[model samples]
Target chain A: MNLPAGETRELLAAEYVLGTLPPTARRRVERWILLHPELAESVRRWEHDFARLAALATPEPPPARCRRRLENFLKNERPRRRLTLIAASFWRYAAPLAVAASLFLVVVLVERVRTVERPPAGIAVLVGRHGHARWVLTMGHDRMHVVVVGRIALPPHKSYELWFEPRAGAPMIPVGLLPNRGLMTARLPAAVYVRLAHAHLLAVSLEPAGGSPTGRPTGPVLATATPQAV
Target chain B: MASPPEPALPSPPPEGRSEDPLAAAFLACRRQDPRGLEKLYELLAPQLFGFLRRMLPRKDLAEEALQDTFVNIWRRIEGYDGARGEIRTWIFAIAHHRAVDILRRERRLVPTPDTDLESLLATAPPETAHEPLAQLEETRLRDCLGRLSQDQRRVLFLAYYHDRTQEEIARRLGSPLGTVKSWMRRGLLGLRRCLETP
Candidate 1:
């Protein structure tokens, strides 16, 4: 039943407790319970109101070890929520970069496939919002992998270049050059986090050819991102 | 496991306005008494386990869920408030939900051939050869269950203890999800009334 605001959560929570809510709708209520403390309370109420009859079921105590295992499980949910929150907040700033990786990886895959149908284990193609692949896959093999970052609509004098993001610890590695067709691949020591199937982001930038002398991307690059989750 | 001799039996009439010492201790322990929680556990764990075993057909699952139930009860105690109802009711709610969550996550259900008939029965527990809690008047429970219509009772059972989602229940009963819903809502009310009667 579509509950009214005045409907007191008693009914909604009760029905929910009853499992009378369909799976999809119940998911919504379950989420709702997490977000709305009041609804959770109502559930607690209905739970107690009828718990007694369970008495009819007859008592069967769990072994002590079962109780100990339960303690560990309860602990798991607490950290699970905290970790989810950490991932959520990190994405606020990191999301745009994640998007760039997808575009870059896809372009590489398309061009490689156009020439050779084999996709190096993983691929990402970077595209312009206008539907153009600016970067294409080139080197990803059993050893070193490279992507051609090109056709980037850049300012007249600026060249686009590629940068590799690592899972952790390593600083962003500056790879090869972006010619006017703007193609560059860093023959990474290991695959970029992006090419290996899972990583945060890979980026492209507007730099003068031969990459940054300082080994970093330069210029107010038009756009960038981490590759896709293959 | 001796029933800690009902030292000072608080006259157990459907717990009224009068604070049930056990309920009070339950609430107090929930508020902060670590020992109170232990006392409450000792007082109620066996009873709750009995409740869960029938709700869950499998012994191992019942035992696992039983442990999970008390752990959650310990964790969620702070969320309970008396205004909603009695403390025991709150604990039962936790136990029921925790059990339901387990059954759903495992994708299992109480074995019933055709859960549709008004006569659908719970997979009865093994012949209680040991018949634990036989003195607890298993007859009264059987009588109370008898008072319920088969359909009403089935709705109650599935809601409290299984993987049957609302849509599944509706589909299984050959009724719309809405009908299944109302049957549950109205069934709970009927159960509440039945339990509360003098």
Candidate 2:
């Protein structure tokens, strides 16, 4: 089975992509491709070359139930709550911390009422994919303030958009876009405020520079949170 | 062993259908867009199911493998690198591996007779005989494929479409193992030459 070095590698790549290599040979080729960049490129080219043959197979659509099954699988797997542990810690210390913080805030407010003005009605700590709190969102009577609490790097032409998903069958509503740096404030319309109060979850998704063109979340959901009464 | 009579080759499709949408959908899937997978299923399920059917013995088995394949695709989409290969290739590779796994599992339980290959080949009509290849509409690869000898084509077809190994193909075609291996290598090399010719 001796072949010229290049020819042998090409044949291996061809057979590998064609699914003809036996289990052992397939595994060996998989390893070999990593060591040889040229072999890897050859494999990719063969894959493209043979792709047409795959497309030529008769289109026998899977049973309709199969679609439902896939949908169910994805639905069950997609919306992961990354901040559950943080939320649990928050709840554990909420009572004592709330009492101490409330007393301190009351005293400070008495002295600085004219300067600080109104307090937020609800506050939420959004957590990123790595389970770290990334943003602090505060909903006031007529506006929402979003402050970045952790480092988030976005591509030059991308931005983060906030969304509110109500518990009922209502569709996800776009709240506002978060600033790429520091803090941002958005005036919350009365209708949006009402929807916000009823929202079961708040999510942030990456979108184009301004926001999602579709007015819906169309990118990877980066973080999620649940607002708590202040 | 007697060779099966040749089936008529299907007519070439109209030129210039694009695979861009499929590639875009795959990219979307990688970005965690749920709709991407739905689009992928719409584009590829039928063809994948047909491919699995040729490889597996029963409809239920084929369907099961197809389901498993998509599930694996969904789970591993994030790991896919577009620079490495086309999305179609990545997907078909998954399906082929899954089909092979299923075949191996089934073979352990109900060993297939080597003699059954001759009858199966004789009776099994080429499933792609009437199907139009939308993606390859402009490519001469199909014509090059047609240029292969019947034996070479059959060996290549079973290996590609049915995910058959050289040993299984030999057992199925009632030919010597070494002969089947040589035919496969020659068939692939020949197709490579023909495809590279122009």
Candidate 3:
């Protein structure tokens, strides 16, 4: 589609800078700005002009807790940076190991194809402390199908719960409770679906018979799995 | 590694109040100084939080946006080129973009029935009176905004302050989407012409 001409183009840029363009249009303009210097210049000009409008709003200081939150974030950031570097190094050394593991997982998945209903958008294999796969999670269109693959033993009145971490260092959201045997399906909420779109990790925590009473996990984490899109 | 020692925390000045402190804090942030990040947050948080509170629907969302804005500023400080524009503008742009992202993700970009456009226009006069050029720019903006028809001004205000999309603005005003788009375009064009005039 042709870019809006002359005055329309400038106004579109103004809307983009003002943050009113719909997602798709905003994304299209973002790509357009990269290819068109004039569009990019207009965006920059509008950014400068609209920056003053921010002053038109009353200046209310953020709550005091916000400072404490920032302090905690900064404190965690340094260690996370180091962890990222270590992760990079680990990926370099463990590349072949990960490839082998992926091939093994594929073979297992192929063998279990008769049990799975449809093609999965993503999958994760949660393992126990002994390095054995305890459960397999397959993400479908609007549900997560989980299958217990290994023998699990739990104390009385205890169950395992699933949690999804959309991004590293972000809080984990409780997905659902894990079944000790047989298949279980957990429906996904729109918010959860949005979060799962960018999720990288899944974990299992031992909880009460029903699930975590609190919205958050209240038990010791038992296992973690790296979620991968198929 | 040990974190850098933090300097004393001074109360943040009002919006458009002090440039030197913000610039200094920005420079410190560029150097990877924690103190600078602290100072920058102190300096920018008040105005940014207020701006975000108006842009987002909920107080918690505004607070999260404010926090994310600082995180982005800290992470991307190395990429910031001073030649392009003032750091304050750049910071506001970051916060605004973050707010939009949240609005889109949460699907909160709906028509807000109770947005008081008149009060929005009446309150929050720029605190830049001490700085003649900034005050002049603010005055020119207010003047140019005043020149537009109420429809045009309302469209701009809803989009800018309330994060309303054109469709939402149309719904809010009981007008056609095409009409809302024209109002936005004409209003922006009129403001540009007026502000650009010497």
Candidate 3, CAPRI quality class derived from DockQ:
acceptable
Q: Estimate each model's TM-score.
A: 0.43, 0.53, 0.59
Quality of candidate 1 docking, DockQ:
0.21
Best by lDDT: 3
Q: Model 2 over residues A147-215: C-alpha lDDT tens digits? A: 675357888889998887654222356666887566666776544554465466889999998877765
State the RMSD for candidate 1: 20.3
* Candidate 3 TM-score versus the reference: 0.59
Better of 2 and 3 by lDDT: 3
TM-score for chain A of every candidate model? Answer: 0.39, 0.51, 0.53
Q: Write down the worst ten-residue block by lDDT for model 1 chain B.
A: B1-10
Candidate 3: the clashing residue pairs are: none
Candidate 1 A-chain TM-score: 0.39
Writing each residue's lDDT as its tens digit, candidate 1 over A37-68 gives: 57767676555545545545545666787656
Per-model DockQ against the true two-chain complex:
0.21, 0.21, 0.26
Stretches > 4 Å off in candidate 3: A1-5, A19-28, A79-86, A90-230, B1-19, B105-114, B128-135
lDDT value for candidate 2?
A: 0.67
For lDDT, candidate 1 versus 3, the one ahead is 3
Error of 1 at A20 (Å): 1.8
Tens-place lDDT digits, model 1, residues B1-198: 222112122232233333445555565554555555566666677778777765665768778777766666666555444545555666676777777666666564445332222322343432333323332334434555667777777777665555466677787778887887677666666655554467
